[model samples]
Target: MDLQTFMKDRKKLVEDALFSYMNAVKAPEVLLESMNYSLKAGGKRLRPLLVLATLKSFGKSEELGMPVACAVEMIHTYSLVHDDLPSMDDDDFRRGKPTNHKVFGEAMAILAGDALLTHSFEVMEDLLNYDVKPIKVVTLMKELAKAAGPTGMVGGQVADMEGEGAQLSLQDLEYIHRNKTGKLLGYSIVAGAILGDATEEQISKLEQFADHLGLAFQIRDDILDIEGDAAKIGKPVGSDTLNEKVTYPSLLTMNGAKEKLEYHIKEAKRILEEIPLESDLLGQLCDLIAKRDH
Candidate 1:
């Protein structure tokens, strides 16, 4: 199948599974509504797609990886919900609609985000039912925790908040994006590799690929903020500047940022070439990340 067709089919599968999983959660009606609100809010299901794509690259069944894929997406959605809270980005819209806190109120929005985060682990436990080894499942769970916890996304977020409106070195900026945006992304690929029974060497190479891909992803995001249309990107352009957040373009200059984006894309694809698996899908994904407008 072509890359576009492959992504469309797998994206639908991920969306269906997300809806089913959210429907199974028993909670107060309003809380569930709040959770489902952001969960259903439209965005590229890139993280989960990465999981299934990595599995497919290794000739594993996508169904076997679905649980992990959904779990990772849940964690991602939860982060967005919290990130839009009054205490954080304070954004009023997401995916072309009111943000969770705006529609559900801040207290319920916070609870909903908490619910998604905790429930992701519960969803991951379902992996045991798929005949996956308990040890592998345990490892994935531990990795997911670390990726989403203090030393990863949360730490990056704290650093990003602290660095706002200040002059930050490129190294420091890279550190913030790698952990804040890259750790969970890296986890998605690594989880698939583990489930697909990748050799240790292949897993290591894929991790390196994911790291570069993650930075490329963030660079594209920064570029979009400058040149993207709100109708397509589903938010106001220039919000980063308005918020006093330092972006790649702001620090490196627009031309320099684009150059860095291309570098990361090339590096990610180069690492993919070194892996033994049929990694064309992953390579195509790297290009997509580099060029995605939203």
Candidate 2:
């Protein structure tokens, strides 16, 4: 199938399922509103889409991966919620609307973030229960915990906030992005690999692809900060520059960052090519990000 059609058909269902699960939480009403606000906010849904796409390519039913996909999105949304807080990026706007902390108080926003983070693990654990064996669920838990913990996404966040305006080195940028963004993206694919029962080699290949994919996403985000429209991006276009943040575009020229994005995209596709679990439509998905105007 063509990649656009494939993605269009699947993204809808993945998002629908994700939102429905969040809706069904039926937790305390106000807390649920805070959690659902950011969860339902507009995004490309790239993380969950990756989870579903990887699982699809590996012959797993999308339903089998739906819980994990929802979990990935929840973790992703949780990050965005915290990232916009006063103690963090301190942005008031996200996805063209007020951020969580802007709508709810900082404390409520913090609680919402905590709730989303904790609930994501619950969703993942439930997904693993669908697997054939106890060992499979245990393995899934291991992968999710590692990706979400201090060793991965959370570690990257701490470094990024603390390192801001510190004149970081190139290695520092890589370290932060690799963990903060890349690790969770890596777990999306790894989660798919485990659920789909991919071979060890395929899992490794997908993990590598995910790392490159995550870097590309971050680099493009940097580029967007430089060249993107404020209205489309839903925040100040020059905020990165305003913050004097160290980014690929700030360190190198815009053209140089573009080159790096292409390099990683090619690297990702090359890794995908070597894997027996090729999606045939993966290139379009990569290109979707690489060429996205918004």
Candidate 3:
């Protein structure tokens, strides 16, 4: 398949699925609108695409993974809504539009994020309709919780907040990136494998691949903040610098960060090859992570 066309098509599927889920939920009018605002904000839809692509790599049908894919995107979008709050990244813009708080006010934005986060679990339950095994549903829910909960993304967010303006060690930086950014991504990849009933060996390899891919993804984001076109990126360059946050580029010099990104990308691809599945789609995703402009 043409990788770009494949990605675009899957992205559209995720977007449509997300919109439908949000629309079906009954909520206060403004709250629903606020949630939809950020949910509708255009992104690369990378997380959900990872779910679909990983499932495809194992010869599993996308239909079985669609709910999981859309649910992850909900969780991800909620994170972004909170991440852009005045108390958090405090950014004025996201995806080229005003941040949720800017458009919806801080309280509404917080509620919107809360609604989305909780609603994701509800969406995940939709898998039951497809004759998915209860055990698999439980596993998927557990994976989602572990990836987004205190020991996962929230812990990393806290570490990141505390590390601002402090001189963070390379180890400390990786800790932040691995949990803050990497865990959910790792979950996305592994969840697909689980849904596909991939062998233990294949799941193990994908986990390693995800770990490398997650780090590479964050490092690339840091690089883009320093050197990417602001218009294309949909946010000003140097936001991390402006916030005094320690990032890959901040801890490692530009060249050092680039080298690290390259290493992770290479490692991720190597792990995929070791899995020895039909991995062209997944390999292309690795390349996209390494080289995405936005």
Candidate 4:
């Protein structure tokens, strides 16, 4: 499967699934509006793409990818919504629009994040109805919970908020970011492996690729924050520096960050090359990661 097409198509799939799921909610008007506002915010939908494309590489149907894709994006979007809260990163805008907390009240934003986070599991239940083993579903859910909950995204967020303005050591920074940002990316690929019925070896290879690419993506994000076009990135330029957050670009020169990105891209490709049926689209996805503007 083409990575670009997978990303584009899977994103649309997730959007449709999200809308379909939203239709079932019997919440109050104010809560529903707040949830919609956060859910509809523009994003790259990278997590969902990772889940779908990885499954596609294994010749899995788009049907299996749909629920997992939607769930991953829901978890991701929830993270962003909370990240922009006044008590957290305190940003005014997200994906070029007012943040959930800004448009709705902070309380509602919190509730929205909570709802999306838990609703992801409900979405998954609706997705896998046949042919899949119950043990496999339970395993994947355990993995997702670890990656999205306190041991993963939330734990990372804790460090992020605490580390602000503090000059962190290299190890400290890596630990925070690897968990905060990288874990979800890691989870996306892992979900595909588990759901697609990949071998243990195949799962390991995909995990390695996702882990490296996730960090590389975050490094590129740091670079973009310093030098990216705000119009394209949709975030304030130099926001990292402004927040006194420790990042790759802050620790290394522009050329050094570029070198690190190159290093990871090579590593991602190298892993894929070792796996059977690893097509050109997988490599292209790494290339896209290396060259993404936003």
Q: lDDT by residue for model 1 over 196-240, one digit each (tens)?
A: 999999999999999999999999999999999888888889988
lDDT of 3 by residue, 1-294 (tens): 666888888888888888988889988999999999998896888889889888888888887888988888888999999999988888898888899999989999999999889999999999999888999999999989999989899899999889889999999999998989899999999999998889889999999999999999999999999999999898889988887888888778999999999999999998888886765898888888888998
Q: In candidate 1, which residue pairs get closer than 3 Å at backbone N, Cα or C atoms, i.e. clash?
A: none
Model 3 TM-score is: 0.97
What's model 3's overall lDDT? Answer: 0.90
Q: Candidate 4: what lDDT?
A: 0.83
Residue pairs in collision within model 2: none
Across 1-294, the per-residue lDDT of candidate 2 in tens digits comes to: 576777678778877887777876868889999998998895877777777777778877868888778888888898899989997888888877899999989999999999998888777666645655768877777887789889999999999988887988878999999999999888987887778889888888888888888899899999998898877777778888888889999887899999999999999999888987646655566787787767
Task: List TM-score per model, in order.
Answer: 0.98, 0.94, 0.97, 0.96
Q: Which regions of candidate 2 deviate over 4 angstroms?
A: 128-131
Model 4 error, position 239 (Å): 1.0
Which residue pairs show backbone clashes in model 4? none
Residue ranges of candidate 1 with Cα displaced over 4 Å: none
Q: Order of all candidates by lDDT, from best down to worst?
A: 1, 3, 2, 4
